[model samples]
Target: MDALDGRLIRLLAEEPRIGVLECSRRLQVARGTVQARLDRLQAKGVISGFGPEVDPAAIGYPVTAFATLEISQGQGADVRAHLARVPEVLELHTITGIGDMLVRIVARSNADLQRVIDRVVGFDGIVRSSTAIVLENPVPYRILPLVDQAAAE
Candidate 1:
């Protein structure tokens, strides 16, 4: 959570496949130092995984929607498991506002979205669901700004 750590994170984020040796060369630090920092960062859970980031739209699924689900009483676990089985379900979060759970889903088309929605709400534990299709994403998901702000501090 220092400048070095932030820089290391940004470096990796920009070049996920970059090796530790190259990182050391670019950062002007020893290879061992880069490795140690990376190890420490991983151990601290600051860096979760090195998996590739896939875009839903690029893979034929361009339609994006968010569904807010109201599940049956005490059916959170069951609902969660049911939702987990659905491949289109991208992210799920429990909320305290108007809905019990919020979910991000993707589909090949608007009509396909209905099928996905049906699957999402098929479980008996799910009471109701309200969906909103995404028109555009002016600002997509990003963390670099937060990283830079934290680094400056």
Candidate 2:
């Protein structure tokens, strides 16, 4: 992508709902140009779907924990599939570390957290799991940094 594509992506990443007309107005380009660029970006998979960012606390899950799991007897895919079916398991990653997988989970209460841990450990392939509850969160979630901006500067 060129500088113009970078600018368009940066603007859209900040405000996905901004219409083509408004983007064109801001960038001083024609509306059709903005629309065409956006369409091309989408077609190329550079710009994916735009959706809401919800707060877990507001939805009744005030607790957050990071879980480290060790799979037993090479239960990889099965463990991943089981975790995928669970609602509280927000994000799971296969990382290069001592643990087999790392999971981010949210729960309503301490008991709820225990239940989550129990359920996770109950999976056939999982041998052991450890959890660390987050006491405070300063920075939550945000979009990726605009790499295009940095390259230009």
Top-lDDT candidate index: 1
Worst ten in a row by lDDT for model 2: 142-151
Tell me, by TM-score, which candidate is best: 1
Error of 1 at 70 (Å): 0.7
Model 1 lDDT tens row, 62-148:
999999999989999999999999999999999988989999999999999999999999999998889999999999999888988
lDDT of 2 at 102: 97
Local accuracy by lDDT, each model? 0.95, 0.86
Estimate the TM-score for candidate 2. 0.85
The digit string of per-residue lDDT tens for model 2 on 42-89 reads 898887877876888899999999999999766898999999988999
Q: Give TM-scores for every candidate, taking all chains together and pairing residue i with residue i.
A: 0.97, 0.85
Which pairs clash in model 2? none
* Segments in model 1 whose C-alpha atoms lie over 4 Å from true places: none
Off by over 4 Å in 2: 144-153
- Report backbone clashes per prediction: 0, 0
